[model samples]
Target: MNLIKKSAIALCALAMVFTACSDDDNDDKNTLGDKEGILLVTFGSSFPDPQETFKNIDNAAKKRFAGETIKWGYTSDIIINKLRQGNGEGSLKGQIIDNDTPQEALEIMVKDGFSKFEVQSLHVIPGEEFDELKEAIHAFKEKYEGVSVKIGRPLLDSDADIKAVADILAVKFSEELKDGPVLLMGHGTPHAADAQYLKLQSELQKLNPNFFVGTVEGIGFDAGTTSIGGILAELDKLSPKATKVTITPLMSIAGDHANNDMNGNTGESELSEQSWKERLEGKGYTVNTVMKGLGDYNEINKIWMDHLEDAE
Candidate 1:
């Protein structure tokens, strides 16, 4: 080939390479420029299946708010430390890195120049954990005056939220409610805000007469109210001749409490302590434990998405 023709061909090839590199660089720049994001905050769970709860919520948020980024933060320090120290459960070992405390996650996001943050709490009630998350967001608002940080309400934050969640659970567990009473287990708190659970129970029972709510903590019971024990007592009265009971976690994720404390088989003799399943079975009731978190349900997840929209 002539020298001039060969030179022209080489120039065209170099130009093509340059154009490809330019397009790749622009793509990275565009991704970085989209700074608005959702910081999904949850009380981290060590259970492997519950890890998908975060992913599900994150995916929903991303779909609802397309073009926005998504990050995760856990409210528990112990879970964060456990995962960081490489001591989480076998299935969760490699899946817990993003499970840092909300503060750590927020700070990291800010450092990365994420200026617009929608902090969505995966907490069921507006209890201690939700309060702490709100406080963190407020602190961030003060410190980073230029950044925009808006807080999303917990699942049962308002009267509407309570009613909506009740309706969703009622439908999700309708089959069990048809056969036997359905009992939901929540991680109740000692905080005064534990009153949220009582309100939630009221709304749920209104939807299904046999639906009942209980807490791991006893803070939710009062004059006319019921604790877990109280709910169990009510169950006995409601079904004096009943032989079957259905139990499920009312929390966002069916983590340790759901898997072990509530449904651990008594046959695992090393962990021989009787769980809720054993306790109910001991009461002569055939217990059917459902290993599902509230977040596992799509309608329940949409409630959080709705809260995000309302907050926005």
Candidate 2:
């Protein structure tokens, strides 16, 4: 009876040891920190060239953070819906992913078992979209107890960043400056963050007298210095000898606003009534519009990478 009891105890102990080993193996297989990735969130564009512009930014990020998997998200529901519905413009219909918001991208990463990752904004300013992105991250952080996440800043986060952007723009439009005034159009917001556009204008003006910035939203903080009207008035006061004005987007992608608001036609019968290009031409200044987003510049895109590297 004693031998039988000992034999039974030995078998039980062996079974317990095997079960512990199996559990350890399972834990190793399901380790929480085993994978990580990056998600680049932006306002999104359906325009063909700007779609490539986004790809360029993504490529730069992949090169900068070589090993990590990189993903993308668009903050605009209208754009995403258009892309998913196969109605996006040109060849870009196939390029844009279908996620409507950064939260969806985060949910996807979580679903894919990414235990850690970073969310980087491609926004030019820390305005409404960036604020919404932060809220999404906060919610995810609460829900995903074991997942680690970090966020990167927008392009114009600090005075130093703004100056850097100005320096790059100075280099980019060096030749154009000689011909005429270079006006950059930023998408303005009612949020106090619109101050960034004014600061950017100041920085660019400090770099070169001919450089200016204006907004489409007419929320320019200064008493009379942000709309196309305000900029034109200021130009009239300066009486620049240059006979031409070069216009370009200060936003990440030169999509709807850059195409229609800044360079579209101006007529009672036209769809766009008062474009910057038409308004400047009407003022007797020859207009030159550069329909390229800031992200199209490698130097400008590098600023985003620097921001990503700064994230902890």
Candidate 3:
């Protein structure tokens, strides 16, 4: 072959090799690595005290899955916006809190070399928030090919879960049960999963007649079975007539719903929108409030951890 022709062929072959190498490099950049990460997604609370509940869950997850990358995601845009705007009430007031949404958190993990993720939902029920988290994860997976993600179910995903939570509550509120009825106020949803509240109530009643469950939104399979009015009716039916009641939140964190809707005081006027405390007081019964979340309880947190383990 002529020297000029051979030289030209050699140069072309070398250029093809370089092109292949560049393509390989680009592929490597898009592909995820072998590292695993845990993303705990919650509806999120703007209240400062509830932030501790998230911290507790994060710490527990880190302890359980030591050396694994762990991060948090807030599913609620309203809470995220409030925190970012420094409009968060109480301790969060005037302090801008930078928290990531589920999508952003997952992207951060991917950038940090996490390829496998166990996305756990810290929601009380598999309701709207939980559904949105799932959708976000789905979109994330579509955006990032070759990444593996498994989602942990919410706190109450099945009848077994309801029963398990009921058992925990029975022990958690044993002392309150002795005094009189213990009312648990959950953040109810328009979603069908709201019926889980009724199932939980039934389970708790089986454990102790003094146990009752209600919702702030007054939604469920039967609103009458999961609302404050329903609780009042049941309270009246309590044999021997209960003279006192203890109210507590069934949510992961005792934030706005627990503080305002369940236990808020709206002055002495009988006409104002009544909180659970005021309603119970108006019923002529001694009422007490417990401002704590389910996450505050180790056993309840363990249940969530178990769900994560199952997902893994």
Name the candidate that leads on TM-score.
3
| Leading candidate by lDDT | 3
Clash pairs for candidate 3: none
1 or 3, which is superior by TM-score? Answer: 3
Q: Lowest-scoring 10 consecutive residues by lDDT in candidate 2?
A: 25-34
> What's model 3's TM-score?
0.87
Residue 161 in model 1: shift from native, Å? 0.7
Ranking of candidates on TM-score, top first: 3, 2, 1
Task: Report the error of model 2 at residue 301, Å.
Answer: 1.1
Q: After superposition, how far is residue 224 of candidate 2 from its true place, in Å?
A: 8.1
CA RMSD (A), model 1: 9.8
lDDT for each residue of candidate 2 in 1-312, tens digit (9 for 90 to 100) = 999999999999999999999987654344354478998999997777788788788889988999888889998989888878877667765474555578788776766778788888999889998899888888877776667888899999999999999999999999999898899999888776878888888898898989989988873336533888888877887764568889999999889889888988757565546888888888899988888898899999999999998875
Relative to the true structure, candidate 2 reaches a TM of 0.86
Give the better candidate number (1 or 2) by TM-score. 2
N/CA/C clash count, model 1: 0
The segments of candidate 1 whose C-alpha lies over 4 angstroms from its true place after superposition are 1-34, 93-97, 223-225, 265-273
